[model samples]
Target: MSDEEKRVLLNNAWCRDADASFAFGYALRADKFGIVIEGKCAKCGCAIVRCSY
Candidate 1:
């Protein structure tokens, strides 16, 4: 995904390190309904997923 889209997802995801950015683990997955982004919080190292339609 583009940097802008990644930024939006990372900003909106519910993560412990709210002030930090995220490091994407894989490419985005899209289904008929929406998109799924899987990654980890840069600061806390916790797994996170952001889904968007």
Candidate 2:
């Protein structure tokens, strides 16, 4: 993904266990509703998926 898009996605990211990490890149994929960005949390390492329309 583009740097700007990555920045925007991470800006709105959240994790159930803790604050999400600012990683290098996310696993991007397509979904029925929108684009899905997957990553891990900084504190707890839980899976985090953010969907962008």
Candidate 3:
């Protein structure tokens, strides 16, 4: 996926989590392999999700 698309997806995901009052933070990284996302729940500072496309 393109960088822009990855960014939009990450933003949407984080917003959804926030709307639910589930504190979270996410990072979108792109490289030769592909797009990858690493997310953490701020409530407990634990890794909650990871996605690649």
- The model with the greatest TM-score is 2
* Ranking, TM-score, top scorer first: 2, 1, 3
Using Cα atoms with residue i matched to residue i, what is each candidate's TM-score against the true structure? 0.60, 0.69, 0.37
Alpha-carbon local distance difference test for all models: 0.71, 0.75, 0.53
Q: Write the per-residue lDDT of candidate 1 for residues 1-53, one digit (tens) a residue.
A: 78898678667776665655566564578878688877777767778777898
Off by over 4 Å in 2: 22-25
lDDT per residue for candidate 2 within 1-53, as digits (tens), equals 68898778777888766765645456878789888888777667778788899
Each candidate: how many clashes? 0, 0, 0
Q: How far is candidate 3 from the true structure (C-alpha RMSD, Å)?
A: 5.1
In Å, residue 8's CA in model 2 sits off its true spot by 0.6
Show where candidate 1 strays beyond 4 Å: 1-3, 17-19, 24-26
Against the correct fold, how does model 3 do in TM-score? 0.37
